[model samples]
Target: MGHYSLGVDIGGTFTDIVLLDVQSGDHFSHKELTTPDQPELGVLRGVRILLKRCAVQPQQVVRVVHATTLFTNALIERRGAVTGMITTEGFRDVLEIGRERRYDLYDNFLELIEPLVPRELRLEVAERTEPDGSISRPLDRDQLLAAGQKLKTLGVESIAVAFLHSYRNPEHETAAVQMLQAQLPGIAISSSAAVVAEIREYERFSTTVANAYVKPLADRYISSLEDSLRQEGITAPLFLMQSNGGLVHTKEAKRLPVQLLESGPAAGALVAAQFGRDVSETKILAFDMGGTTAKLSVIEDGEPLVAYTFEAARQKRFRTGSGLPIKISTIELIEIGAGGGSIAHVDHLGLLKVGPRSAGSQPGPACYQKGGEHPTVTDANLCLGYLNPDTFAGGTMKISEAAAKQALDTVAKTLDMDTASCVPGVTDVVNENMAAAARVHIAERGGDAREYSLLVTGGGGPLHGYSVAKKLRLRRMLCPPSAGVASALGLLIAPPKVTRVTTFSNRLSQIKIDALEHAYQELEASAVQTLKESGASSTALVTRRYADLRFVGQGFELVTELPAGPYGDSTPDRIRELFADEYKRVFAITPPVNDVEIVNVRIDVSGAADAKLGKQRDEAATESRVPVRRKAYCPDLAKTVDMPVHQRANLVAGATVAGPAIVEESVSTLIVGSHGSFELLENGIIAVELNTGDRA
Candidate 1:
């Protein structure tokens, strides 16, 4: 009996499926337009296509990994189930109160984010837990039971349990849950301590609410998907991609779906990091422009940066604290509503705005001929001659160039310009928007965009990589094979992993090593259990640790990786040295007089698995000499030129292409600008560099 692995990624516009023969390393991919009415429709369709194309029996599939933006979309669109929250009596408004600090202090009109759980839905119970994990006050069992019944009567789909200081001690929360289960068995429940287990009250409360909001939907979807797979004879264990850049068993994922809010984007970051590992000493700015959004992440030293919390459904798209804060260990990335399906129009000032609104897959872009009259980036790409009408999606869907012209002409006529002018106008605006977002995001992270190599992946990424790179004065861009479904492919590269966080808050010198070690042991055990449940083999275990430490008086902390071994024998000197090294890298110097405190400790347990991406073949020994040509817009030269085109399959080892060329693959295109050239690296990467008017 042969075994196979399947990865399913559901996006805003399309659902992608990848089937791999675990033994032979053969793979097949399929893409289907998403059905917002029922996401499972697209997922099932894509899976059927992939399995059919590979002529593989579903029973042969040993494991299935799924990633979706459904939770994220539900939050952003405010389409989640009716949910209610239960918290400590005194903290009923914690989510609304927040820190009370305005992100922009001087701006009086700054909009505040609306709490996910409105006051009406936030029921209070007399229960309290101290920060030290001691029960300050016993939970009112009767009160919690009554509250559960009240919520059930009100037709609440789910309930969030977020008692004060629950991170330190979840006893009260657990008791409350027991009571809620006894009284309201139908309502789904999410506990904060189980989800985030961190110190912040507002973040914890909000995260719990977010979890409650999405639990019902996630549970239904996961259940439906599982049944569908089983019906197709796929008895494989199913896993889901979490925000922490790891895979979790489907059973655990349902219990804690909040960790998967940014699952799709995190998978993209994983793909970028895997690519980065092959290119030594390269800083990567990963660009993933799909149908509904363009996602960006900064990768340094082959690891994507991690963030503790992210806001979703932001009222103000680019600003923090303008949306529901979700607490999870997620690969930090920024998103802009600037993708192929992003709508374009002339604004009130007669200035063109590319988007924050998307046409999406239902009607899609006008070029998709799905009844969308709105001009979109895809329409613009079609009008600008970047997309092939018959070859789009491998000719699976017919693209109407005439429809694109009509849509672009609408914007053009409104602006007193032509479609040609309108197309570039929208394209330029989109590029500038992406570039500006890149600048702000990179600067905040204390990075210079010019110093990083841009790895563009996704359907729309290659189409706009050149222009965006030019805007940022970046000369290099690399597009991987199957870039359109890169996120799904990335699922194969990710390890089975878990990130557990605990708040310690003790001065390093005065810390009780025994208690700390015990905490670490517990966390590690939990992580190992999670991995085992996910079907990780014994040989795959790889446990790593980190701590969030800072000077006693500092408001923020820096994360430092900790050595994992026999915790009892480790010296303070070893710990201090690691802290100092990380500290100096950020602040240039460590204070000799300041007392350092370990605020939080994080444990990451990983189970390594074989990445299915085959090793790079030697190009010189394996490719053809065929080079086709196409007319493309060269922004540097500021004109449409007949550019040499080469099938990526034919570009072998040592193959070099000068500027003003296009490397077309089945999945994506790599545009070589007039100021840069590309060469096939021995490791299978198309290494891009500045031409500087000289060539080897």
Candidate 2:
């Protein structure tokens, strides 16, 4: 009997499943069109297909890991359960006020994302807790009951309770939850402290509300998936990928679905980081361009950057403070609406514009022949001969070149240009858009993108990576095997981990070693419990501590790692020195007279999973294979050229191909520009090195 593991990643346009043999290191993958109405349908379909193809029995699968963009879709589509919020009396408008900062300071009519909970649904209760965790006013049971009754009358399916200072003392919020659960039986309720026990009330409240809004939907979906899997005789443990590139059990995922908002993207980053580690590339730019969005992240020192906060459903895609802020640990990445299914059209200014809107799986692109009329990035790729019309989706899903031409023709007529001319423009626009976003993202992180190697993943990533990399002046790019479904691979590689944080506001000089130790002990205990519940063994657990520190009066804090120890009087000084070092590294200067304050304490507990899989070494090709030549539109040359098409499977280690070529794989295609060269590495990765001096 052979043991195996299954990983599934559900995206907007496709659900990808990968089955890995634990002992043999064999892997098979399948991609199915996503059913937006019920994403699990696509997941199950892909899983069954992959299993049957691999001849693997359900019982042989020992672990099942999954990642999805369902919660994020729901948030963006405003399709979550009808939700209401209950907050401390005077803070009912915190979600709306949101620091009163405009994302676009110059735009007179700048619009912000509408609050998920409207003012009418944002009720207030009479309760108060001071910043020091002292009760200033007790919870008024009558007011809470009244609020519950009103919420019930309003037909709210879920409720969120966010009392001010609940991060320091959750007792008031806990009492309110108990009362609401009793008064409003069968309704889903979430408390801010339980969701994010950190200082910022607005961010905490928003995160809790977001969680509650999606809780019912996530619970139902997860239950349905489990039941379906059981019926299929796959009774393996199910784990969900989190936004922080960690794995959490399905039960915990349902309780905190907000943590899974960026789960799929995070998985891509994790895989990119792992690939970087394997190749000894410490600095990498992970580029994931799927059917609906493009995500970019920075990986340094074998780890993806992690941020303590994220914005969801931003009105301005590139602008901060334009969305609902959620206080949760997440892989720091920049996402833009640039993907294969992104619709293209001529804007009011008579200029071609690529999307922020996607056709999704239902309509897909015009080439899918599913009655979509609009031209899309995929259609442009097809028209430009970048995609295979006959062998698309491994020949299972046929693409219609006629449909693609017609769609592009319609858009070209609007621009008064030929379809061939318009095709390159579309591709160039989307690539430049992604490159520009990546540039801004890297620059903001205090790094130059040109200094990093690009690791491309996702269905469309390889197809567009070279062009984007060229725009960023990047000289090297890598497309690993199974790049199209890298997120699913990432699920298997991720560890079972939990991160817990609590608000601890104290000046460094005023901090007591005993109090600090106690706080960490509580956090570690909670993490241990979570890891146990997630099926990780206690013996394999590892714990690390960090504190969010800043000079007094600073608006934000930098995370500083702490040493594990039995606290002595010298510990405070040691921590202060660590903070100073980090501060200097980030800002290039540390204030000599400024007092440092610790605002939040975080503890991360992780347990390594059995991620060992067999590797198959690639042998050198026996002979130099002749490339199939095809007439393809070359954007750099502004004309059609005979481009070499090489089947990736036929290439072996040390196989090198040069210039204006297409490396075709069943799942994706890698386009080498006029001045680029590609070599197959021993590990089955295609390493494309570009001449930076070339125009294309």
Candidate 3:
């Protein structure tokens, strides 16, 4: 009669699974190379292996939460379902005529995300909704049926129905969906209003198309995985992590898979926030670097920032407006240079470049002996002796130093340098790439990197955290006890959260408070219902209100949380002040005018949370442990040094290990530099404090 919750995350390079004892706070984790051809197979295998190792019965699992990067990769790689679009007449070309703004004007052949539905498959239907939430011309069931029949004949797996101004009045979109579902029972249908009930028809259309694109894939994967788990004797209720860093029922995820685009990375950010608050560090930069990519998120006041709109499948990783606009609530993060498996190659200009591309799992880093001929960050670390070949991945993943050196030697010959020189270059270039991108993101938010501690997680984060922090001039870093599988742990720690949004435009001076209150109440009820459907108890539900506001003539809006409200006469003034404060916070200037307008209203409801992450340190029973000497390359000194190596398991609370040391765990390793010291905090966090003089 044990209470256990299982969490699993599938990444581009690896699949991570964790089993937590909700009663005793004990946990066991496992990692393996991802089976790209069938991502869920790897996760299923990893879970079985972990449960077997811990001698726990599969039936003991009472809850299961899963997150994966499969959806995001599918969208970026254009591997999603074949989808068709059924839109209002003359607006069928809206997907092609997006925004009409060039992301990069100078490039003649600039690549943009291709419309998910080809023009041939984008059929037109006769229907219209007025701008003011009224039906103008509607009830063209014949045209809608004709379009559905044509799409089915074209062999489309799903269809997106988006009519102009559907966000304001959804009746046309809803009626069209019902008609399509009745005629084409086999096809999945997505409505723009149901997916994104906000302003801007272009973004709504794009997001609806995206949901249709991923629906078939998610349905197949989730249903298959659930059946497989049940056959394996684990009859737990299954849940999924969404991009907004919240858990949702499997049904909800399948119905709206676009929301899961950043699920895996979102969990990492959540775990970082939890650890940030545990040690009293309210502001932190969460750095999660895995085999294929590194994701950076900012946590302020012990919570990760949440954004409603973000682009996907960008041609330029850091450039705004270079990708398909996706309107969904997401934990804001900037993804840049990849992790250990990121390839390193000399550019045509004779300069070395670390990755936006990676070797991934099929042929990971050269050290993995998996047929990869390219040198990668992991290969460089292995060649430099920072990674212990005998202890990597719990010694389950065998690595070859000779192979790593051979890969580095090839890159060195091109630069007319020795392998030793090229090894450090790879690590340095990758660190700089990550730091540079992170700096831009932090600065955009008006934050200084030096003012925040770097909370590092993932298989490769700890190995490079010190270098990245140094480059950013950060004074401190934190690598928690179970950093490698932090995402899976987060799935257990996260609560079920539901978000509802609507377009409600009105100038501040002329707005109706009673109408606004009515809108908020409706939104709250919808969100609360969704939470309940996700199996959350109603008693402890918490609701938060937000407003997307802007100056009267501004094109974009700033999101601000509304003060708790039974909103009344006084609420408008308070809201106006909040909008002004937020505007100033973002722009660092007084508002151009006191005239403000509310563009949208949003509500978020969070269910009861049972945080299961371990709070107590895994301390040694009685004795203190000593470190053994190991020779590893020192990047700062540009030479090899005999560094003190210690097993992370043996380190107790309050134990301090000084510079030029190695802290090794089965799944990950931490390399402390000569300029800093690693202190084991009472809360099981390893705080890396750099010497103040090192800034010189």
Candidate 4:
């Protein structure tokens, strides 16, 4: 009975549910329209449908891994629990004083994201910790009680505790948190040192407060989900996907929901990395375009980039400084942009613009025919004949081309053009938006966009990937099997991982190896203990060591992986050489002769990844094959053309299809332009190679 693993990814517009047979490594998936008001209902509905449809019993499900965007949406919409902040005296304004930098320096009117805890809720207590990690003054118990009382009186559901020099010595913060929990039973409390044991004051406090703000809401959702799963007779141990492309027990997720901010997208990136390695391509630009947003990530050397800090709830999507900063171990991704449900309209300046706003699942896109009259990218695709009316979502849902064109008339008429004439521009605008973002994102990472192959995932990704790749001047694109549910598939293969971070400031020459060794052992033990409590099992457990290093006087540092060591004498020079190589690669300049400083030390412990543990070739290899001919509007040729359409399931390994053509699947469709040829590889991916010297 314990032979299946289930994975669910709750996205903005769709809840993807996949059931994997552990004995056979075969998987089946279904997508359900998300219920925004009560997300758990939609997830439960999809779970039941997939299980019953696949004829799988609930008792067969032994493990469940879930990834969700609920907490991130809550943060962006400012709908989290009422939260308060407790800090040392004279640091009451840390949130407001946020590095004292403006995102848009020249704009006359600039608005920053308001702190999660209001000024009235940010109370300070008497405490002092010197820069040298000495506790000069003891904690004031009376003041702490008074602060807790004020928060309770104000109806604060959660509280964050932060004190000066907490990274070096968390005694005051820990004691205060323990007291608050004992005195104020049932109130959620978070300590800054526990959340992020680093040196930055504002960022640490912000990360802690963000954790507290989302605590109650996440706890409620997780509890509800677990209860619903139990009611459905699926009593598997449920795990949650973290933003770092790792799995953690539900208890850890509930305690620190902020770390799940980019959970779903991070899963997609992980799957992309695995897919790239499978194809022997180490560098990949993973493009995931869902209903509401498109995310891009760069993977090099078969691993996605890992960033130590992230910005959340940005005022502007592409602007770096216009958001709340949180410190954590997370997969690095480009800023999000337009996707399938992004609205299309003419601006005040008489130019068409795609969105930073979306028509979410409730109303969805116009072609869904559920009361949405505004034109969207989905509507444009339908008007262009890229989507079929009867086969949308494997015939579970239907779309109307007439309704799509009627909706497009809103913008077409405004531009004094027919819907056919106005349609290509909508797709072009969206594709260019994604391509521009990709180019800039790759350039900022010191890589060229043309150097990486595009790997497409999500419902919208395959439909738009060809155009985006052309605009980026990329030579190849790849579409995985079961593209629409890739993120959910990713969750099924995610290994349990835990990270431990601490500050250790010292120059390379003066480094105390014995002290560092002791700290590393403690951090490793902590991470191992947390992983043990999660109850995940995998072969070949692994530990990675990293340090944040920088030139002696630099304001920021680059995270560098350090060689595992039983350090005695040669460790300092090894670290120095690694730092110099990385520095020269990034800046194209030689490192200074002076010794550099190590700002932070981190350890990430993970089991051998599940995707590596086992893989079953897709079932498409055994299916009967058939190809049909259909006439669809070719955007590249600016005319309707007759092309052969093949069902992805019917195509066996090594089959080739030349464009212009369409490869249709149950959940997604691939639109290949006339400038490329697609080959169904042995691993079930349609690898597209563009014709050289031809621009689509």
Candidate 3 local lDDT, 1-696, one digit each (tens): 859899998987888888888987777788889999988788888888888887889989999999998899889999999999988888988888899888998989988768988999999877778889787787589878988998999999999999999888889888888888888888999999889999987899999999999999999999999999999999988999999988999888988899999999999999999999999898899999998999999999999998899999998987788899999999999887578889989999999988878999988888888899898999988877788888787666889999989988888999999888788889999999899988999888887888889999999899999999988988999999778888888889999998889999998899999999999999999888888888899999989999999989889999999987798889989998988888788888965587889999998889876656764232233355777787898756778999888887777778677898888876778988998889888877899997645444
> What shift in Å separates residue 91 of candidate 1 from its native position after superposition?
1.4
Candidate 2: 10-residue stretch with minimal lDDT: 613-622
Model 4 regions more than 4 Å off: 537-539, 611-626, 692-696
lDDT of 4 by residue, 137-174 (tens): 99999999999999999999999999998999999999
Model 4 / residue 226 / CA error / Å: 0.7
Task: Give all candidate RMSDs, comma-separated.
Answer: 2.7, 2.1, 1.7, 1.9
For candidate 2, write residues 430-459 as lDDT tens digits: 999999989898888778888999999998
lDDT of 1 by residue, 560-606 (tens): 88888556545455777888899888778888645678888889988
After TM-score superposition, the amount by which residue 211's alpha carbon in candidate 4 deviates from its true location, in angstroms, is 0.6
- The candidates, ranked best first by TM-score, are 3, 4, 2, 1
